[model samples]
Target: MSLLDSWTRDLHEAEDGTIRPTYRKGTGPGVIVIHELPGLTPAVIDFADEVVEAGFTVVLPHFFGHPEARSNPGTLTGALVQVCTSSEFTKLATGVTAPLADWLRSLARTLHAELGGPGVGALGMCFTGGFALATMVDESVAAAVVAQPSVPFAIGKKRAADLNLSPADTDAVVARAAAGCQVLGLRYRKDRATGTRFDTLRELLGDNFVGVEFEGKGHATLTEHRQQEAVDRVLEFFEEKLKG
Candidate 1:
């Protein structure tokens, strides 16, 4: 059976006319769960299921790759190629928001308008991690979680520290943070894939940035390299920010 059989699948269209498949389930406040490098693997679905059980509506948008495919080197490579070649993504540029973020922000606004809450929660992992932070620039996203945000490819010092946000978008995120919207970040201290962006987040968001760094080496905190403690912190953050 397909892992997403239980999810209500629909194609969501952004204001810019960008349409993508989205799978939604559960109830209560809404949360947008953007997949990682490969796609919506079973592990990613499992995490979303836990969020559903925790009493909140969750939406998984199919940005790229085959849904429910297991994460493997081949899958990762294929997705990377697709993302890199696509204009929607900013693979190696610094201080620029991926064009994909506009669609994501539109999705957040739609979900928030439908749910009728103060805002919606957004969790982006790995390749899409910083997307949650970008989406938070809008008032619709109240709780933003970025787990191992590896964007701009982390190829060099500049890209490593890049937040993958344009100057205007960065200012908007900073303003939102100052308005009391807290962003949660998770990653391993030694995970070079994430680069030094966490430090940049600290400098930019100040006290509004709540960082959860695990010791040792690992990546994909909420999916591939799942950590119970980190998962718990994410749930608690969602509860406090989205449901409180």
Candidate 2:
């Protein structure tokens, strides 16, 4: 049997008419777990399954790649090419939110409406990490987790410090942070892929930004590297924010 056999597959249409397949499972409060590059691999699915076991409904959206494909150099290259070339993502552009964030926000609203809680949770990893922060502009998302956000290629000083948000969206996120909405971020201290945006998050969100930095060189704290402590922290955050 496939790893996704338990998930109920469905199509979600965004406000801009973008349709994507989403796999869902579990019950209780809702959480949208966006996968890293190379699509929804087994590791990502396992993390999502943990979220379900933690007593929250989880949705895994299929953004790219063959679902359940293992992450390898070839798959990573293919997904990187797709992400770099796709018009939906903002890759190397600073101060601009990816157009794909609109779809994610739409999905958050749909989940919030379906579950009827304070709001839903959004977690994005690797290539899609900052997308979680982008979704926070909407009130429908209460708990946002950014795990190793890498965007704009982090090729330069400006791009490295950028939060992957437009001016308007940045202002909105700042306001939300000031209003007591906390954003949880996890990454390896020396992971260059994550860039210096965590510093920017600290500057912008101040104490509202909760960062969990590991002491080694590794990426994908909740997946590829798979730190149990980080996983526990994320679940604790979800329970406090979503269930409290």
lDDT of 1: 0.92
lDDT of 2 by residue, 1-244 (tens): 9999999999999988899999999999999999999999999999999999999999999988889999999999999888878899988889999999999999999999999888999999988999999998999999999999998778989999988999999999999878877999999999998889999999999999999999999998998898999999999999999999
In candidate 2, position 84 carries an lDDT of 78
Candidate 1 — worst ten consecutive residues by lDDT sum?
216-225
Q: List the residue pairs that clash in candidate 2.
A: 91-152
Poorest lDDT segment (10 consecutive residues) of candidate 2:
77-86
TM-scores of the candidates are 0.98, 0.99
- The residue ranges of model 2 lying beyond 4 angstroms of the native Cα positions read none
Clashing pairs in 1: none
What is the C-alpha local distance difference test score of each model?
0.92, 0.93
lDDT of 1 by residue, 67-132 (tens): 888999999889988898899988888989998898999999999999978899999989999899
Q: Model 2: how far is 67 from its true place, Å?
A: 0.5
RMSD, every candidate, angstroms: 0.8, 0.7
